[model samples]
Target chain A: MKKQTCSRILPLVALLWGVGLCACGDSAPELQRYELRLQGTTSRFSTTYLSATAVQVTLGGAPLRTELLPSSQRMNVANATHAHLVAHFWLRPEQVREGALEATVVLDDFGAFEGTDGSAGFVDAREAPLRLKLQGDALERNGRAVIHIDLDRSIGAERQGSRPLLPHLRLVY
Target chain B: MRLKRQWLLLSLLVPSLAAAHDLECEVSINEQSTLVVREYPATLTFRQVVRNIHPTLPSTLQEATDPLLEPLGWSFTPPPPVAIPVNDSRTYEFSVTVESLEDCARIGQVPPSESVEFTDTLQIGWDQGMATCSARVQCVPADTFVCDDTLYVSSSAGTSTELMPLDPTTLATTPVSSSTGFGYDAMGLSHIDGYLYAISNRNLSGDPIPHVVRVDRVGNIEDLGSLPELAGQEWIVGTIMEDGSYVIGSFLGSQWLRLNPVTLEVLGQGTLPTTTPTAWAANPLDNKIYGYQSYLARMSVFDPYTGDFTVFGPVLGNVGIQPCSCAFQQDGTFLLYCYTSDPTVDALFEVDLVNGVATLLGSTPSLAAGDMASCAFPPAQGATPAVRPSGYYMIHEAALERCLASGPVKLGLLPAVVTKEDALRLLWSSPAFTLGGEHRSEEQAARHALARQTLTGVCNQRLFGGTPELQRLLLDTTTTLGRTRAMSRLERHLGEANGRGLDVALPFSLRGRATPSHALEQLQPRSSP
Candidate 1:
């Protein structure tokens, strides 16, 4: 009688334990989301650097800083991962051109990792150029970033088939 | 035994003409006082093949015809008057009227005293080339450790791939797409426009690639049909052509058939020039197809354009060359590899396309060279002939690396050279019930009963020539065991031993103390038991 009683109660305890194990496996970890807004400027290399020496860049609305672009670029933002950093930038110019700026947003660390392969810690970039344009007095999106490229440009100097050079901006943790 | 008996007769006559034994030719006295020269009967074969092309009599012919005598030169008279009696296809007798032996010599008629003018009767409609098969090998990729799927492999050292299309710094492989139906083989690359091809030996009313299987560039599978000849023959193999056609190796006899790749339609079928080559080499060294007849060990070099063969070789005895495979190169030579199960050794042989002479360049490390695939390449210095694989091999497939939300997921594969990651690989389906496993195009298959299949290179099963009754019995046995859940004991009781007292009802069982073996002795059939 005792053995039977013990056997009957053992199954009940086992079921309870199994339920708790299931809950623990599905528990969620704390997650935090962050975002980085990137801003940049652009200008025609020939028109802007004619009588000048170097270009400059600035974060937010801070003081202007020198910047440089690297070659061997993957030409894409997402594929740039695992690529070596080309070089360091230097601020060389005191004189500034008006309206030569652009902006973009990015999330650094999503706080928590989840799902298979921790892909839960990723983000998908839907923007094609994530680029910008620069103008005197106002920094704007450049290279037909807003409108379709086939529509033809209206503002910059009337050029045959060249797009104005754009600056770089990155958001990192 | 027939061959031995014939050889015995020759040996018995050898003492009369010691030097004549060295001369084996087909010369006869002609009525024009000249000598008539002919090509003698010889055994031609391919490498990796362990059999010989069997010669049957006129009864084996579809319409019962006599064998044709190939005339090579003329001697003694202007060739005797030929007489193949209309209603009788039995014998071929020529009325010779030779004036003098000197006149015959001028026509290259070797006298029977100094040389031999042998006479032989062989079956027509089939090739008489003899050959031996060799082991397989792996070679390519000048230098690399990465894996890649290659498109075609030439007998020479030329490989094609699309590894580095954009960047010159990384793998520089040109993209080779099969979307155009362009295929690679032991011959050069070929393709056809406006048609899909199927290969088979299915023997189906009209199914192509039935017994054999095929895997396309993207790994799509198809079945080829079987043949009607060589009843129950199996292990059919073949390749594709430029005009959406395929040259398939038949199962019953040592011959090749030109068929549609998409529909299993037969355009034409022909035999090889010479039946033999060095080890592991098949013939018909046409622009596209070269195959080895498994049982006959004969290699057929087919020229689909002309529907003819140019040369044949004698059988490769023990110390002779084994023709296993032939991979066409851009130049004149083709990469011919040898495979053997005896020692599990495989080698790469550089075979001269025109001459049919093979030279062993190097060998591959022991592996499963029984059946393999590699991307063909153009010839290179020092690598002009068959180059041995350098250490490791590449991945035998074209693994398309895809970056998913998960890790890198590889899917589609393209043609690439072989190395550590790109070992030569083969793509094919199954031929459990298919035919030649290769068909022509839809237009071709639409005409034949066995169309729409591809002749796969799986020549191991006896699909068409096995005992169906036994197979049915086996199936029934399997089903019965499944139902009863008892499979340990299974035997066929072909009624009890009739002479063994049936059920042992007689006192002392009729024979009194007869043993089981003795009891059945009386029931044994007079002939086979």
Candidate 2:
């Protein structure tokens, strides 16, 4: 009889605790999403080069997440208009000071690393910090980054005699 | 000597009117007449002339051969009709025919006979005179290899099992050999070492047995007997590899059976990466077997040694959807001939290896059930043939690599974060189903099938479309255990990728139970590995 009474009270106590946690939902962190696109330069980023390029999102120079776009997001890299990598990170209400967050999107194009026996790393430039402001749960940024770098035509480089360029990754959030 | 004595006695007995009349005669046989007993039943003719040099002596000539010529079947037709008038010569010809193997061998004996002689008797007004003529006999042997550059085809649609040589330029065909009493369903017509080899489903006795047959140029056939490995399979694809090993494959299954070219013995049998196409021809340029899927409108290259298949993207033209044939053109271009289901739509196409486009060359003869073979090298003509780089294999390999890198994810093998680990685990497993453990093998087979499905999917995407069975294979998931849940979502994504365009949702782990602490913990940087 005593064990049965304890089980009955345990459910009531657990229900009250779940309610208390739900009541403090205002302090919960919400995921902020952003779409990253590559612009500038005459180079066409083929599926192979796009797949080989590693995209990393860092907060205060600390790496938050790293992903290969095609493998991670299943984006159509060959389609120029649809070519873009999506990144996500969670930030608390208090952490969104001044209604903006400064994050650096690093794109490492490994086009030049090809034929280096996997011994070579990134061959091109990294982007500066891009400022992002929250519009609900999504991050919005104005203007795209314009950077000068080598061309990347990895797909037809051999057949077309297109030279392998040190493909630069541009950040447009 | 006895014949000469008889003639002298005849002259002595004839002593009528013992007046001696001047009589001169000469018997001559053409010395340049040669006999070559090449492939039996040979006949050699010898021309003989009897001259009457005595101005008034008219004579009738009688000829007798040496005893050695009796066994050689030497005989005169119409008794030679040797009657010579004054100052004239009577010339007659006789043939020596060799019928059996023994006689042919004797005719070709070493140190050819120098004493093979024939004697002639002349009757001049009851006064007999004799003269003799001698000649040498020489017979050379036949050649073992008869080289031909004619293109050949063995079709299953015709009623005759006779193989035909096809003129690639005009699409004309002439029977290379008489029907060997086998059915016309013989496939895999390949040329190897001056002879045409093919796989016939029916034997000479009309038995439904698959056998290897070698046919010489002049209609003689050497049946190499039944192949036990390919005993029951029908419509087997066959070709000789660059290394000269015979490759027998199946249209429905992936079995690649290699046989020794000379012995017709099994060299090796392994599973191919894909099922054999309807028709196959080895490219002399690369020594790889090229196959065409008339239904799918795609061309694929198969490496016999490596057992790898690199399927080129589908052709971009109106290549027929019926049974067709393929051979390398004289100039080393990929040639295709197809007789469509419509009786009048016979067409030939030249496929561009790099672009995967089929250009219509012209209409072809009725090749509804045709498969072709040719010598890799163009016909021996003026100078050494300069072969430019086809670069076909390189294009195929590049397409295969591209498909492998993106096809799986594009086909929803790894659509979401939850199924990524499982999909990758299954993708990395062995494709062979013959592994020992049952459960493990089933899992491996599932992975293998998925990998194949992915390969077909990517190649099909690059192509116009493909066989229903290929599409069914790509969509089939009954055996992929626990994947039913993921398949529905995969189908949605596939539709999105195929027609609806871009996918709006990202593949992430945010939907399920996520606390603020868990979310913040993901953002925190960890120590470098």
Candidate 3:
């Protein structure tokens, strides 16, 4: 009788453990994958490059900083506009609150994309954080969001012709 | 001395303002081909030079109109950034390439030489102000392009939605199609992606959702989707942007919504600084979205990418005439169509975008006071070269002689053709062909014979001392059958001339191959026979 009771209790405990494992798996939120796309207007990009080398996307108090890979950047000399897929990462749906999330994307302008720019010194730059709106449905449906930064929104004239001072930046998502 | 000092002071206060006004842009086709390979794609390259007309002031080349190359398959490539020094001009080269032609070529398009003329405008934004220059470009190899600036207007009558094809040149309306179940009241029709797109405020499903619908050439409405955020909104202004986005501005509120052309998904929404425009159209040359407020007679520009609205002061000098529908002329002229306070006094006015003046061209067919949309590019030229016979051929002996001279034989009698014989038989069979009397004079008999001959085929007008009326009949004879009959009538009239000394030398140019408008102008005013 004792052996049979022990066997029954062991089988029941094992079943409960398996059920708990399945429940935990169902309760945990699935992460949605997304890509960040950066595009500039063709008219302005033909003159000067958007000197941004890195981007940081922050959501729900957590930030994902990405140094743009060489394969990800397309600062070609072609006088045409292109949408560049710069970064890819995953995010939890819980990170989006109320069907919307405000993303603060920090752009670090290092002026070193393909080493085309001959400038060695830093140009007059502003560290203003660009804010973009990420729609929950957009990510849920398209699995990607775009942030377009206009280089024509520069504030002042270039100090020198070679190192054009890009002071102002506007973000459109 | 006071005037000079005031001028100096003005120059000091507004340096770039005057300099910007001196900036001029000239566009020239550097290279173009008359014959294009129908199977392969072709590219057209042109040069645009921004010259500072002012002898002293330097100007920066700021903004330009990125014209939407028409017929759906064309794309433009703008040159690199341009800058002009003092008294110097900067040249920029641009190219337009035919990306595809399979979709734009319509079925059953006739008269292969399709010619289109559209305006390309460049608005050079200087540091302080702006200057604009425009040039009309005639696109060649027009046979490949079938998409013409065919005007389509929609009605504002509640629940009575109708789309009609409007002739831009004649302002005539013909029914394309009409349907119910969608409320299109106060919505403007916009041509986008080879289809007419409009916003419907009516929630036919009884839900609080407004929908954007597409109307095809045959006027079939396809519901794209419903916009929940735009429910119960009255939008009279709508236009298709360069990025294929449909933007609708509110009629009552200052709100506007940019939507996906295919899905009607709300991509962006913003508020205008002032009241929204009642009429909106994208300039084909620049593809810039411009809005016209009929009540205020003011023009406004909307930047689709940034959601920026800039309104200019009154663009029409005559406030008496209110324009409810706005479109761009083929030459990049801003055209507004409407009437004065009196509904019957409506005409199409060409708005001078820079000076805010409007010149009335001619009367157009009045809509139900609704919005109008047309292709930015004009219909390919030489598409409709239908021959219109001269009405003078019936009355003037010289016209008959001229027609006979051109025939294979220079004889008093016309070469008898089967069509002429058939027409004469048909005329004789009718009771209307009775010779007035045997007592009639030779000229009278000849005129009656001419009338009978004309009535049988297309020229059914009796040239009885009404030259203008005869001219009108000739113009109205737009059918091929009518033209053929009129030609035969000319020959028959010459056959009866009896080789008499031609009284008037009617120019051959006025007879055939002349356009209707050209015929009207060339038919010199003459006393009745």
Candidate 4:
């Protein structure tokens, strides 16, 4: 009877321990995630490098603080606009397990995508890139990043030419 | 003399205040193609629809007027931290979390412990130049981006100084083309080979249908002529093909047509993939096209070659992915930015062609432009060809303050696609006080609206053989559906109490540096001054 009681108590304790571990780590991770990517380019009219005063990125409903290379720390934009600009973003690929995503980029208080400037209709930007992608985990060790510099479109002003501002980010995980 | 000129300049500038002005809204998109912070409040469909629906009457609340929501189910307040932009016009969606979706199963409706009345402030960024190739963009932390002014301008206003900080909850208008190639303005968007397709329209007695014209963007305007093939079709929906071909579509006929970019001649024609194509995106793998055709709740794929099509995605009764744009990533995966009949807050879906599954990447109002590269036919998936928002907008005369007060305000609604064959055009108008349902006849109501107009008090009716302003208003909104400030101002100035006077109603370029009031004074008899 004593042996049976001790065995029964051990099983109950083991069950409780298993439950706690499941709650702590064994639970499923989120399958879906989304990110906001902001990219810039110059018009055919100019071949100068253009940079912004501030960079703010938002996703879902929260304001996401994105790391901008050469922020005020280094200078890619020298108080003037350039013919081209390349903004690179880093995001975790595992987050987009099985969900949806929405993204946008706007000018100060305005949606600047495909904007018609100086009373002109939206013009094709020769320097601004037209594509972004999330590199997979094993492929890119620093998480799936939205890269600005690709072989086709180099990031910089052909005149004062700057390569992709930040060569590579310090991979966190 | 210098002092006199300075005084003259000052006084001359003083009078023009009440002129017709523009209103613009800031918007953004995450990886999901959801529009955040829309200029107009009508974009609240995603967040509004995801609210829970009660099968039974609420014990705490009073009553339920429409039982339609009960049929449609709900999800947890869209997994919190999903920012939705709101305004007075569309705030009714916040307090009520319950919604009746089309195919909500067992857990259709749930009650929110607390009601979240959403509030958003417009964020402004650097305002230097204007013209751009695309309308909006979304970025990710999974990537590191450097912000600059040339390619990427910075945001200036809002607590968060991001340019046009858009919330993912907001939605945008469906893009339709009215190509009238008479290039006085900057509207013709399609670029194939050396020619640019434009909208060329005029209000002629027998000619109700506007026409499209192909003009050279870089050369003399006189060398161009009319494009007769697309003459009768008013709203010509189109995108550039892989081998420099063009695929133009008709929303009314649900017909797809292929044309040689050089000749503007129809190369091929086929029925539209969906009954109602909500959005259009280029196939990442090839020049094929994708549309939600939400009227059918399926992703209808279109091939420009034969004009043939295929249905992709689950046909599970109104899963309600109101497709925005069928954009793609660098690897050639399709991202269908979709919403629901209710504002089920926007979501991003990745179309897995291999398994035929539409995966959810995340949720957002817009997608990134960079995602288009390395993919097949980048322009089709939103390359430099993404139709960006026009710089200036027109506001209703009654909404002068909101239009010109500052930033983050909607100036006017775009003159999108208009159709007589079907009812898709009315989907973008203000849903408030709508006496009819979605399937209701918008044309009949417009006729009644025109019948009730009294424009005789104001004379000088010259256009359309001296027709009344009411008649002109309906004609422009329905027939020509254009994108000029003059047309927009004309639409809002009429049938409203507070108006931006007729003198100041002309486009800013024509009216010069005078204020609205001053401009109006100029229009008045010169002797009065």
| DockQ list for all candidates | 0.00, 0.00, 0.00, 0.01
Q: Which stretches of candidate 1 lie over 4 Å from their true place?
A: A1-173, B1-190, B193-209, B224-231, B235-237, B270-300, B313-323, B340-342, B354-357, B365-529
Best by lDDT: 3
Q: Chain B, model 3, TM-score against the native?
A: 0.42
Give the per-residue lDDT of model 2 (tens digit) for B1-529.
9999999988986553222222232222333422224454666555655556555655554443333344555553325335556787655566666553334445534221111111221211212222223333333222222334456776554334656777767877777555636543324333324445666665556656666766555655556677667766764567765555677776566677777645454656877676567777777778788888655668889887777787788654487566667777545688777776568667777887778888877776575355676655433222111110111111123333333444333433323212222232222222331212122244343444444345434344433232222233344433333564444333322222222111112123211221211221232122110
TM-score (0 to 1) for chain B of model 4:
0.31
Q: Cα RMSD to native, each candidate?
A: 42.2, 41.4, 36.0, 31.3
- The true-versus-predicted C-alpha distance at residue B465 of model 2, in Å, is 48
Q: Supply the global lDDT for candidate 2.
A: 0.43
- C-alpha-based local distance difference test score of model 1: 0.25
How displaced is residue B497 in candidate 3, in Å? 69
Expressed as tens digits, the lDDT of each residue in A43-128 for candidate 3 is 43333323233456555445543333332322321223665665665555555553334454433221211112422211222223
- On residues B272-373, what C-alpha lDDT tens digit does candidate 3 reach at each position? 888777777877677777877666678878887687778785646564436567766556777776766666655766777777777776775456756777
TM-score of 4: 0.25
The estimated TM-scores of all candidates read: 0.24, 0.36, 0.34, 0.25
Model 1, range B1-529, lDDT digits (tens) per residue? 9999999998987544322211001111231111223222211110110111122211111111111122422121212222222222322333322222222232223321111122211111111111111111111111221112232322211111111111112212343222212121222111221111222223323433233333333222223334453233222344444333455543344455665443333567665444422222222223444544333444445566576553355333321343364444333345555564445555555555454555666654332212222222221111111110100001111111110112321111212212211111111100111122232233222211010000000000011111212222233332432311122122111000011111112222111121211111222122110
Proportion of native contacts found in each model? 0.00, 0.00, 0.00, 0.00
lDDT: worst 10-residue window of model 4 chain B: B124-133
Q: Which ranges of candidate 2 are over 4 A from the true structure?
A: A1-173, B1-149, B156-159, B184-192, B315-317, B378-529
Model 4 Cα displacement at B334 (Å)?
A: 1.4
Of 1 and 4, the candidate ahead on TM-score is: 4
Once fitted onto the true fold, the runs of candidate 3 whose alpha carbons sit more than 4 angstroms away are: A1-173, B1-146, B185-192, B313-315, B319-323, B329-331, B377-529
Query: How are the candidates ranked when ordered by TM-score, highest leading?
Result: 2, 3, 4, 1
